[model samples]
Target: MAADDVSVDDKVKRTRDLLSSFYSQDASQISPPSNTTSRFATLDTINTTSFDADQYMNLLVHKSNLEGLLQRHVEMAAEIKNLDTDLQIMKNNIVGMEVNMEQLLDKIMSVQSKSDGVNTLLFEKREHIEKLHRTRNLLRKVQDCKKASEEVMLVIVNKLEDKVSSDSESIQARAEAVMLLKQLDFPVEKLESKLLEKLEQFLEELDLSKDTSSDSANPHESINEGIESDSIPPRPEVPTREFVEAVHAYHVIFPDSEQHLVKLMHDLTTRHFEAAKQQIQEQVSSAKLSNRLRFIWTDVLSIDEVLPEAGLQDFAYEAARDVLKQYVTSLFSYLLHEISDALLQIQKDGIGEEYPLRAALEASKNALIQGSTKVLSDIRYLLDEDLGLVLKLRDMIISWVQEGFQTFFTQLNGQLLLLSGKDVPTDKVSSGLVLVISQLSVFIERDAISRITEEIGSSLLGGSYEYGSSAFYISMRTQRISVLLRKRLTTPNWIKHKEPREVHMFVDLFLQELGAVGSEVKQILPQGLTRRHSRTESNGSTSSSRSNQLRDNRSNTNRARSQLLETHLAKLFKQKMEIFTKIEHTQESVVMTIVKRCLKSLQEFVRLHTFNRSGFQQIQLDMQYLRITLKDNAEDEAAVEFLLDEVIVAAAERCVDPSPLEPAILDRLVQAKLAKTMDQEPVAS
Candidate 1:
C-alpha cells in the first residue's frame, strides 16, 4: 500500500511538471532544476485514489493554479490541429500550382525563343539597311566626284569611312576617314601644317632629329648618348598610336602625303643611321652597335606599319645591310690594324723570335671568328627575332659580311706587303711568317669559313660558295716566299764551299717553322674530341707481319734499307716524310707551297753564285735531304720531285766540277742528318 501511494504520487507530480514546462514562456526558468522536495511536494499534497478525467483536470488546475495558462494551452492545441488541416489543404493546392507553373514556364520559354528570333531578324534587317545606306552613300559620293569639274576620288574616302566601323582595322581606318571628312571642309594648309608638326614630334620622339654631333661634342652628354638616354622618349617598337593617326590624317587629307611622309622618314632614317655610324666610327667594338641599330629599325619598321603603303620594309632591310656591312668592314679593318701593330712591334725587336708571327696570326684569326659570329648573331637578332624577317636580310646581310673578303683580301695582302717593305731584309726566323699567313688563309677558307657559314646557316649563301682570301693568298704564296727568301737565299747561302757533310741549318729552320704552323693551326680550328688509339697490336699475326716486312731491303750491304724498289729507276725513300700534319688546313698542302717556293728560290739563288765541287755536293746533300723531307709533304708528289730535280740540275749547272756524291757516303750523310735530328729532340725537351 505504501509503494502504491508513492507511485500514484509520482504520476501526479509528473503530470504537474509536464503542465508547467509546456505552458512556460521563460525557458530559462524551466532550465533551472527545482529542489527535489519542491518537485514531489505537489504529489505529496495530491489525493491518491482519484485518477478520473474530472479529477485529473481539477488536480492539474489546482497544481497549476492559473486558469489563463490552462485556457491558453487548450486554445493553442485546438489552433494547432486546425492549422495542420489547413496546411494539408494548402499543400494539395501548392502541388497543383507547381504542375500549372511548369506548363506556364514552358510557354514562357517558347515565347522567349520566338522573341530572340525576332530580335535576330530585326538586327539582320537593321544591318542590311545600314549596308544599303553605306553603299548608297558611297555611290552618291562617287557620282558627286564624277560630276565635279575638279573631281577627286571621294569613293575611297567614303569606303574608308564605311570601313572605320569594322572591328579589325577600325582604329587606322577611323583615323583616315575622320581626317578625310575634315579635309572636305577644313583648311588643307592647316591640316598639312598639323601633320608636319606631328611628324616633327614623332621624329623628336624617336630622337632621329637630335643634333647627334652636338651631343657627341659635349663630353657630359656623350656619356648619356645611347638608346638608354633619358633626354629622348623610350623608343616605341611601332609608331605611336597618335603618330599613326596623324600620318593617316595627312595621307587622307593630302594624297601626296605618303610620298611626303616616306621622304621624311627616309631622311630621319638616314640621319639616325648616320648618328649611329658616328658613334662607332672611332670604336666599333666599343659602341653599343646592336642596340642602336635595334632602336633605329624598330622605329622605321614600326612607322612603316602605316607611313608608306609599300617599299619601306625593304628599304629598312637594305639600309640595315649597308650599315652592318660598314661595321663588319670596320671590324676587319680593326683586326688588320691589330695584326699590323703586333707585326710592327715584332719587326723592331723580334729578330730571332719565330713565335710573334704565329701568335699574332692566331690571335687575329680567333678575333675574326668571334667578331664575325657576333656580327651574324646581331644580324639574326635584328632580322629573325626583332623584325620577323629572316631570309631576305639573311641572304643580303650575311652575304655582305661573309663575302667582304672578295674586295678586301687584296687590300689585306697589299697591307701585309707594305708592312714588310721589299727593300727590307728580315731574319730567317721571321722569314717563315709568309707561310704562317698562308696557313691562316687556308684555315679561314677550308675550316673556319665553312664551319661558320654552316653554323650561321646556308639558307642565305645560295648554292655556290667562294673563299677569295684562300685562293688569293694561295695564288700569291710563291710571290710572298720571294719576299721572305731575301733573308734566306742570300749571297752567303749560295757562296758556301763546305763539303757535303750534313743538312744545312735552313732545313732545321724550315722544318721547325712548318711544325709551329701546324701547332698554331691546331689551336685555332675546331677540335671536337680526340681518342688515342691502343698502341698494342691486335694480334701476334700483325707483329709477325711487321717482322716479316722488315727483312726485305734493297741495299745488299749490312747497312739495311727500308724497301727494295720494283724498278731501279724509282727512288726508294723513307715511308714517313709528313711533318706538321694536323687537320686538312695544316697537312701536306700547306707545307708543299712553301717548299716549292723555297726550292724555286734556291734554283734562282744558285744561278746568282758559282759553286766549286764541294759546295756543289753540299748543295746536292741539302737538296737530297730536302727532297726526302718535302716529297711526301706535297699534294703533287711528282711536281715536288720535278722541282727538287730542277734545283739539283741548277746546282750542277752552277758547279765548276759537278760530280755525283758516292751512294754510301750520301746515304751515310742522310742517315747522320736524320740521327742528329732525332738526338736533338730529347735535348730540346
Candidate 2:
C-alpha cells in the first residue's frame, strides 16, 4: 500500500503541475486526484489474479473522470485571467472620465465670467442712453431760444435799417434843396412874390375865360397845350426829396409800376425819332447826282480790251470813277437813313440796352470804316487815270462815308436820350430808311455796268440796254444787313431767353420775299429753243410776190439784225450767269463760316450753363472783365474790322469783273464787217 500510495501521490502531483503549466493559471497550486492515479497504477502493476475485468474497467473510468475534472479547472482559470484584463481596462476608462469632468467645470467658470462682464457693459450703456436723452431735451430747449433770439434780432435790424434809410433820405433832401438854392439865378426873396402875383393874374384870366362859346374855345385848351409842350421837351425832374418820394411812393403803391414807364418810353421814342429825322435832314445833302454809272460785264465786256492798249488803265479808272461816284452818294445817304431808323426802332422797342446801342454804333462805324476805303478805291478805279481826278473821286467817297458813319453813330447817342423817356419820333424812318438802303446795292451794280459800257468800244454798244451793277451791289448790301439782323433777333441770348415769336414772323416774311424772287426767276426762264413764241410768229404772216422778194430781202436783213441781237443777248446771259455763280459761291463760303461760328457759340453756351451754380456768377463777372479787357485792347474791334475788310471786299470783288468780254466779242464782229466792206468794192472803179 505504501509504495503504490506513494507512486500514485507522485503521479497526482505531476498531473497537477502539468495542468498548471498548460493553463498558465494558479489555482491554489492544486494537486490532481491522487486516488485516481493510485487506482490506475494498482490496476496495471499489481498482478491481481483475483481482479475481474469489470473492476479494472471501473478503475479506468475513475481515472478518466479525474482527468476531465483537471481540464475543466484549467478552462475556468483561463476565463478568470481574461476577466482580470477587462477589469484593468475599465479602471483606466474611469480615470479618463474623471479628468474630463474637471475640464468641463473650468469651462463653466469661464462662461460665468464673460456673462458677468456683459451684464456690467449693459448697465453702463443704459445709463449713457439716459444721459443722451437728457442732453437731447436740453438741445431742443436751446433751439427754441435761438429761434426766438433770431426773430428779435431780425425785427431790430429791420427797424434800424428803416430809421437809417429815413435819416439818409432827409439828408439827401436837404442837400438837394441847398443845391437848388445855389443854382437859382433870381433873388429868392423877390422871386416868390412876383411868381405868386403872376399866378393870381393867370387864375383870374382862367376864371374870366368861361364867357366865350366859339368852336375853338375850350377852358382846358391852354393847360393841355402847356402839358403837350412839356411832353415835347421832357426834362428830367430835379433830384428833390419830393420827386424821389413820389417815385418811391408810386413804386410802393403800385407794385407793377411799368405802366407809367411804358407810356413814358413810348413818348420818348417818338420825340427822339422825330429829332433824329430832323438831324438827318439837316445833315444829309439831297442832291440829284448825274447818272454816270455803267455795267462792266464779267467776260462779256472789258475796259482794257475795249480801249487802246495805252488807254487801258485810263479807261478802267474813268469807268470805275463814273460808276462809283453815283453809287457812293446814294449809298451814304441810304446808310445814314437806315442807321437812323434802326436807332429809333431800338428806342421804341425798349431794346436799346438789350441790343447794346454802343455795340451797334461800333459795328456800324467799323462797317463804314472798312467799306469807305474800298468804296474810295473803286471810285478812283472808275475815274480817268489823271491822278488828280482819281484822288478827287476817292476823297469824295471817303468824305461821304465818314460823314454818313458819323451821322449814324450820332443817332445811337440820340437813342440813349430817347431811352431816358424824352419824346422822340424815330419810328417813322424805319421803312423809308430800309427802302433806301435796299436800293443802294442795286444802284451801285447798275451804275458800274453802265459806266463800263461807256468806256467800251463804240461797236460793243449794240442796243439801248444798260447793266444794273449798282443795283446788284445795293441788293447784296441789303441782304447782308438783313441776315445779320435776322440772326441777332432770333438767337436765344439776343432776346435774353425770351424767344420773341415776332422775330420768327419777320424772318418768315424775309424768307417769303426770297421765295418769290426765286419763283420769278424760275417762271421767266425759256423752256426750250424749239418752242417759238406764238405772239412773235402771229404778227409775221402777210405780203405780195415781187413785193415779197423785196420783203424777203428786208426779211433777210432783219434776220441778220436778229442774229446780232441774239449774240448780244447771249453775252448778257453769260455775264448774268457768271455773276450768279460768283454770288452763290461767296454766299456758300460765308454761310459755312457763319455756321461754324454758331456751333462754337452753342458749345460755349452749354459749357457755361454746366458749371456749378455758385461758379456761374463768378464766370459771368470774369467774362465781363475779359470783354472789358478785350475792348480796351481793341482786339475784338480789330478782328471785326479785319473780317469786314476781308469778307466784304472779297465778295465785292467777285461782283465786279476783273476781265470783261464784250470788247473781244465786238472786235471780231468789227473785223468781219471791215473785211466784208473791202470785198464789196468794185474790181475796177
Candidate 3:
C-alpha cells in the first residue's frame, strides 16, 4: 500500500511537470511532455499486494456499473460525429447564398444608372418645346398686324379708282379711309404726298400721249392745221375735258385746291372782258359795233362749251352781261353829249337881238328833229336789222334802249331849261313842246311801238296773222299803240307840275282836231239831216165852215211850197256827193286814236294837279262841253265818263289848303258848270 501510494505521488508529480513544460514551450508546436519514460517507470513500480474476499465482492459489483458507463460514452461519441457533418453542410450553403447576393446587387446598380440617363434626356426635351411655343406666339402677332395693314391699303385703292372714273363721286369715302389708316398706325401724310406726286405724273404722261397720237395721225399737217384739228378749237382757249377731269380728281382728293382753280378761271374771264371794252371804245359805226357784240357772244358760248363740267359756264355768262352793259352806256353817253352841245350853241347864238325869239324857236325845232332822226336811225338799224340774237336777248336789249332814251330826254329837258333862262313865253314854249311831242309820238307810235307790237304778236301767234290783211291784228295794233302811248308818253308824270301847261294844251289841240273830224263824219250820215216829228190837233167844227177855212189856206201854201221843194232837192244831191268823197278818204282808226289820246291826256292831267276855285270851275265847264261833243265819236262813252269823274275826285283830294275841299263841294260846282254849259249848247246850235 505504501509503495502504491509512493508511485501515485510520483505519477502526479510527473504529469504536473509535463504540463508545466508543455505550457512553457513555443505555442505553435504543442505535444505531451518529452519525459514520457519516467512516467511509465513510475507506473511499473506500483506494488503487487494480497487480495481479500470482501474486497473482491465489492470490485465485481463496481465492474457492472463501469459497463453501463461505457455504453453512455459510446452514444456521446456518435452524436459528436453527426453534429460535425451538419456543420460542414451549413458552411457549403453559406458559400452558395453569397454568390446569389452578389449577382442581385450588380443588377440593381445597372438599373439605377439607366434611370438617371433617361431623366437628363427628358429635361433637355422640355426646354426645347418651351422655346418653340414662345416663337410661335411671336409669329402669330406679326401675322395679325400684317393682315390689318393689308385691309386698309385695299380701301384706299378703291376710293381712288372711283374718283377717276366719275365726276359726281362723293369724297366721303376717301375721308373715311384716311381715318382708318391713322387708327392702324399707318403713315398717312407721307402716303398722301406720294399719291399726289403720282397723280401729277399721270397727268403729264396723258398729255404727252395725246400730243404724240395727234402728231402721228397727221404727220404732214402744218402747225395751224394741227391746232385746228383739236376737237374744241382754241378761240376762247380753255382746258380740255380730259385735263379738267384730272384736275377735278386732284380737287376731290385734296379739297383745299378748288378755290385756287376757281380764281384762275375768274381772272381769265376778266382779261377777256377788258379786251372787249377796248374794242368797243375804238368802234365808230353801228355796223362795226354790232359785229363786235356778236363776236363777244360767240366767244362766251365757245368757252362755256369747252369746260362745261368745270363750273365755269356761269362765270362766262356774267362776263358777257358786263360787256353788253358797257356798250349800251357808251352809246347813250355819246347821244346825250351831242344834244347838250347843240342846246348850248343855240343859247350862245341867240344872245343878240338879231336872232329873234321866233327864229330861235324855229332853229331849236330843226336842231331837235335832226338830232332825234340820227338817234332813231341808229337804234332802228341795231334792233330791226340784226337777226341772229335770241328773242330773250333781243327783249333785254330793247329794254336797255328804252331806258337809255328816257335818260337822254331827261338831260335834254334840263339843257332846254338852262338855255331859255325863263325869258321865253309860256305859249311859245308850249307850242315848241307840242311840236316836239308830236314828232316823238309819230316816230314811237308809227315806227318803234308798232313794230314791237307786231313782233310780239308774231312770236305769240307763230306768224299766223298778217299785218295789213288781218282785221283782228289791225285792231290789236291800234289798241296796243293807245295803251303804250298812255303808259309811256302821257303817264301821270307828263302832266305833273314841272310841265303841266304843255300837256294840258296838247290835250286841247287833240280834242279840237278830233272834233273837226266828227263834224265831217256827221255831214255824211243821213241821221244828221232828219228832224223831230210835230204833233197834230184833232178838234172838229161845221163842215162848210171847216171847208172854207181849209180851201183858202191850202191853195196859197201849195203854190209857194212847190217852188221851194224843187230848188232844195238839187242842192241836197250836190252835198251828198261831196260827203261820199270825204268818207272814202277817211280812216276810222285815225279818228279813234285821236279821240282816245285826247281823253287819256285830259284825265291824267286833271288827276295830277289841284287848282283854285275859278280854275276848277273853268275846267269842269270845258269837260262838260267836251263830253257832249265826244259822246258821238268816242268808242266807249262810259269809260270816258268814269275816267273824267276819277280825275275830278283826285283833283279835289289834292287841293292846296290846310284842309282839302270836300268832294261834295266839287260835285256841286261840277254840276252847276255842267248846267251852264248845257244851257249855252242850245243857243250855239
Best by lDDT: 1
Name model 1 segments beyond 4 Å from true: 1-191, 194-206, 209-242, 252-258, 279-301, 308-310, 347-386, 406-408, 423-685
Which runs in model 3 stand beyond 4 Å of their true positions? 1-259, 278-284, 310-319, 346-367, 384-391, 422-472, 475-685
Report the candidate with higher lDDT, 1 versus 2.
Answer: 1
lDDT of every predicted structure (CA atoms): 0.56, 0.37, 0.46
Worst 10 residues of 3 by lDDT: 576-585
What lDDT tens digits, residue by residue, belong to model 2 across residues 65-178? 865556545744764575466567777987988898888888888888998898887988889989999999999999999999988766755554344234344433433332
Q: Residue-pair clashes per candidate, as listed? A: 0, 62, 0
- Candidate 3 lDDT over residue span 237-327, tens digit each: 2323333444444455456555544553455455555656775575334444444444444544544454344455566556656665666
What is the per-residue lDDT of model 1 for residues 258-315, given as tens digits with 9 covering 90 to 100? 6777777676677667766775576543224544665666666666766657466777
* Lowest-sum lDDT 10-residue window in model 1: 532-541
- Give the top-scoring candidate (TM-score): 1
**1 versus 3: better lDDT goes to:** 1
TM-score of each: 0.32, 0.14, 0.28
Off by over 4 Å in 2: 1-320, 350-685
